[model samples]
Target chain A: MSDTADLTFLQTLRRVLHQERQIESGTVIYNLPVPFGFRSS
Target chain B: MQFALTEDQTAVRDMARGFADEKIAPHALKWDEDKHLPLDVIREAAALGIGGIYIKDDVGGSGMSRFDAALIFEALATGCPAVSSFISIHNMAAWMIDGFGSLQQRRKWLPQLCTMEKVASYCLTEPGAGSDAAALRTRAVRDGDHYVVNGQKQFISGGGVSDIYVTMVRTGAEGAGGISALVIDGKTPGVSFGANERKMGWNAQPTRAVIFENARVPVAHRLGDEGIGFKIAMAGLDGGRLNIAACSLGGAQAALDKSLAYMKVRKAFGKRLDEFQALQFKVADMATELEAARTFLWRAAASLDAKSPDASMLCAMAKRFATDVGFEVANDALQLHGGYGYLSEYGIEKIVRDLRVHQILEGTNEIMRVIISRKLIEGAR
Candidate 1:
């Protein structure tokens, strides 16, 4: 849900695509701002 | 080309996600282990208005759009595919009844269905008729104020557990024209159910053969006219296919999420597995494919809501593509997990198993391609 206005299409694609898989050294860091809550009644 | 979801849809999706995570995720494995159909859990979900999501609000339903329902299913499936798929079946029957049933029939069924006080199942596929549904052999002879039905329906989800069955019966002639949609109470006399079927997946719900031996149903239970059952069944399937596709997307997304988490912590060659370019490429491809499938399914759902001429064809295409991609993504996610993926404790293997049937149900993927081809040929003329 982040703004992609400044990034190029390819760059935006990479960032959006790998955002969940971003790793720092041996530790895994999930940068997704959205919580696991997608279920609405 | 609009990728954004409306506020209402997003709210529904989020509510479904929260409910799934709290109610379904923690107990999915247990349900699978015991082969338990959690009717209580399902009823809780229905209390949220998903039971009759697409039905008019005037009839106690949410009156949501097909796209909105698709989004909700995807989010729910993130908790458990089997549970979500069963919910989809319930919605399919509820929608059919609301759309085709007489005003009196709606008054009798929709309130309870909307509240999930009564559960419903669809009876279209028979033992002899799977792909060729038009050739179904279930007969319903009209006898005064009631119809005596003598036939069998197979692969019915929530078969023994459902309270109402939206059934397709042969009423008049042969082929499609003879078919008529009937609402039969599941507890009717002479209506019996076979033993629960053991399947490769979808274990959270029961699948059984519904046997009708001279079951007497009132004439007033018929939906629409007598000869339009096949059309009603097909129309229901158009939305059913989208829901099944959405369930696949949710399963694959879960698998991908698990894989990404595993790759970050798991080590190989004295470094993180995700640091390798080959594995990164795989992750990238999985993400891209899943994203593409989700967006395409949204478009198909929108087309269905619009009642476009090509809605059926688009539904076929979306179901075929999304299910295929979902399976592939889940399989790849399993491979990424190495040995741990095969184990039940990790849950990756469960997603792969659950998603395998999405291609087979709601019409096989091969049938989907055939539909697309036929539509293309017709459009050319």
Candidate 2:
């Protein structure tokens, strides 16, 4: 039972990672990171 | 990623499916019409190790994981959602004792509970407190070796028929901090039950108000220390939510399957219903949505099994989405059946009615949003 449950947990993590990759690919084209800027006095 | 079920999981699902088809489906309509709580059928299920699906094996339980429980419940609900959900409630109560009760408490209660010799009910909801569970007023005054319990729990499943009630009561000051959980015997003095409520659905199981007036429960019956009853109840609900969602999945899947079979045979305007492109698209959409909800539910179940930090939030999301989808799909299937679906003989209307309450119980979908949003905002901070 524990082994099956652990395998299911691993599968869930893989699904999450797969979804995150899809989101990341979309974000690269649509949501660029902003750079931090300092005031020059 | 392995999206498919392992061989062991498939075997478990098939076993439950066979039991449901042979034992539960043929009589579900009669049971619903007669409002019968089929203890014999329930005991049969218990014999198959369903009574303590996730409880530790030492106590005569199956000791399966939450994911396995999800699969078992979903398959069982294909036969009758009401029966399957009542079993879920019983397991939740037994698990409380196994998870929190002392060794003696577990020994005294679990074996009988696991074997279905003594059915259990969970007592947390009250007439005054539904969403705000922390506001529960059931009071348990410490008196020597026993706690004198007072106040009433409303809408308790298996209230009159159950042998034991895992109850929550206030022990100290007001609010959530004062609450404590107790495993109260059904035969205890001053413990009485109200009439079985006339409900919208889930008629196969009884729902009644459990009234306690000076009911004496042993101190040993307390699940945990004072001030954590609400916590325990909430924790139990995390898994309870998953099971209920799985029940929704099964019910919807059954309805969808019926729709497919019906459309194949029932003709319209000299052509079969399935021959129409629009109807085919509708069936396609239903199947897609059901699959999506089911996969999401499995993820939440896996998170629970892994004890992930966000398991609770994921559970709320799954419960909300799956139940809503379940209801919509069942209702749509009913529509697809046309006038025949409205008739009791077709069995589609019953599934629609049964799926409706899934949105309300195990914490309302609105409350699910509350839990999910709270986690989201907290994580943002």
Candidate 3:
């Protein structure tokens, strides 16, 4: 696994939620940063 | 504000709906009658590549967002919730193991799992631990290379039929700190399956009790650290709730669709049932609530996909609200159908029964309230 290949799960989540472009081919972008207020409810 | 489905989401959704119409709808009535859960149906679904939903492309997967998976479930569930739920549980099991398992573990298992060659179960609740999963007595003591697992899992979805169980057992002492997750293959010695549960509804999906009697799970099978099982399960449930909510949305959609078709032709005191202003109001209400829930479902799922701080709580809210609304809307649709809805042939009855369980499973509505309320009371939640 390359250095970039090992993105932490949360970091990967952040990128997916924040960015729209493909992280790689065929994988759907899953960028969804949870807002803080909703976290606190 | 833009809570609309993208072109891709819409395509997957339509494909799922079409697949269900062709594959699930005709047999749903008979499957319900025989109480035979066709595991092959699920295997065929897994072959679609939606089954490996959350896992990466490298691990025999076509990575898709949780939100996208939710869309698929809702669409299939619109045709047959029993089939949809079974697929959901299998996907749930696959997601956890894929997320936490080691590369060698992923390499060995993900291929079979993603492809639906083998099915997996998630075992957490026990005879004594329904809502209080942490109070579970299933224990796993360290014995060198293997952990000796001894415990019982209750209401296990895909129970006897599953090839593997991603189960939770206590590794340390007591309470939340002691629990850990381990993957156990069905062929393992000392592992046994309890009889399928006879339930109020959702009979087409077989749920049963599972007993782990000195089942030896390799240390390599252990997920996360010794004390991380509770956290792992909690995190999984946060998303699981959302997926279950999606199932509710699907079933509700099915019910509404049936009711709409019925109302257009069925006559009452007037030309047609839908011609009545009262019935029109009811239709309007169901549509309005469903619209709200669909948007909420996607927003919550998107939040989780983003890892937003509020993702978990939003998921809880979405699960609670969507399922509750689904139950109400489905019941009302049944009401609109009158005596015909009660008949098995209408299929509205089945949707009602299946959606009812949505309120209880994947973390009950009560637990959802607790989670939502806890978030409100605690700081930095």
Candidate 4:
């Protein structure tokens, strides 16, 4: 629930952020819906 | 071929690292424990001249390149990623205003922001928007000479503390084409800050929602051309992601450095822990992956500096790789520390907690994967 979007982008937006892996099949606009509201403190 | 830090940049990074260690690092535990950082340390940082990295001197800034700014980010995040986030966001917002704001807007805002007289926030991700920013539902309807903004923005870092918000709204039509960037004055009527939401990490800088119920922003507050808000926001965030990745690299650097020092001195089972091959391999992997990530981050920044078509793809890649690497490194450091890593005095647990957010914000690592894979397919085609 906590975010650093205001003072910093240091906290990567949960939706768009991730560890990227090269796709064997080329494509654009990958739909990876984020699991928001998960608190990991 | 070029990865070495410039002389001045090295000096700046060193100074910031020194400041963080001497000032922010020792105090980071207490601040994270209570989730409050002193303003005086930030004020002191402002005086150091690296405060306005990548902004021009004529605009009351240090005029350092994005590369130099990345170095500063990495260095400062070493001591405390939370406090570093606060300072870096100020600079990032300053960069956008300087780059895209009108002369009047710049003259009105940059001096105060650059000099740290006023803190700033970049507001783009709404509750419904997130990665699908083109679908952002925040509305800014024109009424008379001013625009009345309505809707809520979640995950705003300097929400309550910032004097201004670089707000993105739907001004023209629909989709990405309709988005317009506006500089909403913090004290504007109908502009109100939500209570600081207690976050898992980066508590030093408050993150909250901003609600605008017909918040009237002046016509003069618009940045760049009409309906170019999404463009401006995207441009700013490309660099924003790079800087965030730098913060990851920086924090990971600190975590690795600390863990290595800890492993050597701590004796277990009648032997130094560094002699343990399993632990050594983990450290080795951490160091190697971090180096790869750092290389990737700088390469991405350089590509942006060169305005490469690949810059966009590289930004996501660097952000995704560095952040994941950061999380891995932090978690491994904690494991290496065993039970002590979970304790606050060691500060490893806090670093672990802080790094957990890296994979989540500034475009979640999931979205980064999406962006990169999309680019991969398109380029191949």
Highest DockQ among the candidates is held by which one?
1
RMSD of 2: 12.3
CAPRI band of model 1?
incorrect
CA error at residue B162 for candidate 4, angstroms: 0.6
DockQ for all models: 0.15, 0.01, 0.04, 0.02
TM-score of each: 0.90, 0.90, 0.89, 0.88
Write down the worst ten-residue block by lDDT for model 4 chain B. Answer: B6-15
Q: After superposition, how far is residue B259 of candidate 4 from its true place, in Å?
A: 1.1
lDDT per residue (tens digit) for residues B1-381 in model 1: 678975445666777888788889899888888999888988777766677778776566766788988888998898899999999999999999999988899989988887789989999999999999999999999899999999999999999999999999999888999999999999999899999999988999999999999999999999999999999999999999999999999999999999999999999989999999999999999999999999999999999999999999999999999999999999999999999999988988888999999999999999999899999998899
Per-residue CA lDDT of candidate 2, range B1-381, in tens?
Answer: 578996447656776776788889899999999999999998877766688888777667776889989998999999999999999999998988988888889989998897799999999999999999999999999999999999999999999999999999999898888999999999999999999999878999999999999999989889989888988998899999999999999999999999999999999999999999999999999999999999999999999999999999999999999999999999999999999999989999999999999999999999999999999999999
Give the Cα-based TM-score of candidate 4 against the true structure: 0.88
lDDT value for model 2? 0.88
TM-score of model 3 (CA atoms) = 0.89
Poorest 10 consecutive residues by lDDT, candidate 2 chain A: A32-41
lDDT of 2 by residue, A1-41 (tens): 22323222213223333356567855322111111110110
* Model 1: per-residue Cα lDDT at residue B146: 98
Instruction: Give DockQ: model 4.
Output: 0.02
Error of 1 at B88 (Å): 0.4
- Looking at model 1 chain A, which ten-residue stretch has the lowest summed lDDT? A5-14
Error of 1 at B129 (Å): 0.5
- For model 2, name the residue pairs that clash: none
What is the DockQ ranking, best to worst?
1, 3, 4, 2
lDDT for residue B158 in candidate 2, whole number 0-100? 99
| Predicted candidate 4 versus true structure: per-residue lDDT over B149-245, tens digit per residue | 9999989988988898999999988899998888998898898878888877897788999999989899788898778988888788788888888
